[model samples]
Target: MNITYNQFLISDDKSLLQLDAICGFLGRSYWADRWSRETIAKSIENSLCYGIYDGGKQIGFARVVTDYATMYWLCDVYVDETYRGTGIGKKLIESITSSDELGGLSGILGTKDAHGLYEQYGFVRIPDRFMRKFPG
Candidate 1:
């Protein structure tokens, strides 16, 4: 399977639409509702967003919030349900981690279920320094 991993710019409407589709497949309707089209447009424009396309259609999405020097928080990683288990996710993570923009930083993410996948890429659980803050 030849998948094209492309850098997504803010002006990419097709990529954004693909992202929306991927999110829906992942059961992330909350994201679909919470983020307006303008918000997604802005995110693509300013953030590090990547899309994996099969032929010409998007099948995976990943975003990175990075300082471009120190740390990168890998977030919103989702592969279309139909495309899961075929190494698209691995390729997406590899593509992002190998980029000069993120290669040297500490990559971090918290996954509810895909810890094993992340761990294979050298992401270990931080047993001692974990903390979170939620809406009160």
Candidate 2:
């Protein structure tokens, strides 16, 4: 699906995704700063990816890791530094949370600084109920 907002667009078309731009977003993020380009590429290949565009240039991105019926992990969400505060981030989250394919499944994400943003979409701080384990 493609959603238009003003002159920008949010699309679930993986074919429209630009690898170089996505790498730039993830590479600069504190959370995913350690992620290699290959890792980012492989992750996008296996997950449901979304790209936000200004005309043909990719300006934002997000991807959902999911089991379709059980739950989804929203990760690697980023809007270019140049596009911040334009309601693009909020629109991106809205698009994801309201998507027909992911609407009914529980969603979780890890954000050191975006708590306020996600909370507007019903995500609460559940540090007590969340846990993680490193893969071997």
Candidate 3:
């Protein structure tokens, strides 16, 4: 099946559904506990959301939180288990990186198992450069 990546439109019904479904399947960390259809829709309305479609069904998703001026944080990226190993993730990252809106900005993401994948897109771990503290 051919895959295509397109910008997510907030007002579109199908787009909203696809967004919620993707969040349901792949959202982790704080997102898994906090994201709702309404919240996801709002974020899509505000940020850069991309949906990956296989044939006609939505099968992957990614979004970048950026100022469009200096920095971009790529998040909420995932391919359906059935669609893994098929280059959808790479395409999504490529699409985001190549977009004019995200151009010339520092893009970053934190991944637990896909360092190799992100490396292909030029993402690297900044060892000891940053630290995190989760709220109790």
Top lDDT prediction, candidate number: 2
What is the C-alpha lDDT profile of model 1 across 1-136, one tens digit per residue?
Answer: 1235443222123334464564454455333446656666676667677767666567667777877889999877877777777777887777677676787888998776888888888899876697988656
lDDT of 3 by residue, 1-136 (tens): 1223443211123343365567665554445447676777777777777777655567667777888899998877777787777666777677677667775789888877789888887788888787789868
What is the alpha-carbon lDDT for the whole of candidate 3?
0.67
Per-candidate Cα lDDT values, in order, are 0.67, 0.95, 0.67
Q: Candidate 2 — which residues are off by over 4 angstroms?
A: none
In Å, residue 76's CA in model 2 sits off its true spot by: 0.4
TM-score of each: 0.74, 0.96, 0.75
How far residue 9's Cα lies from its native spot in candidate 2, in Å, is 0.8
In model 2, how large is the Cα lDDT of residue 120?
99
What order do you get sorting by TM-score, best first?
2, 3, 1
Which of the numbered candidates is closest to the native, going by highest TM-score?
2
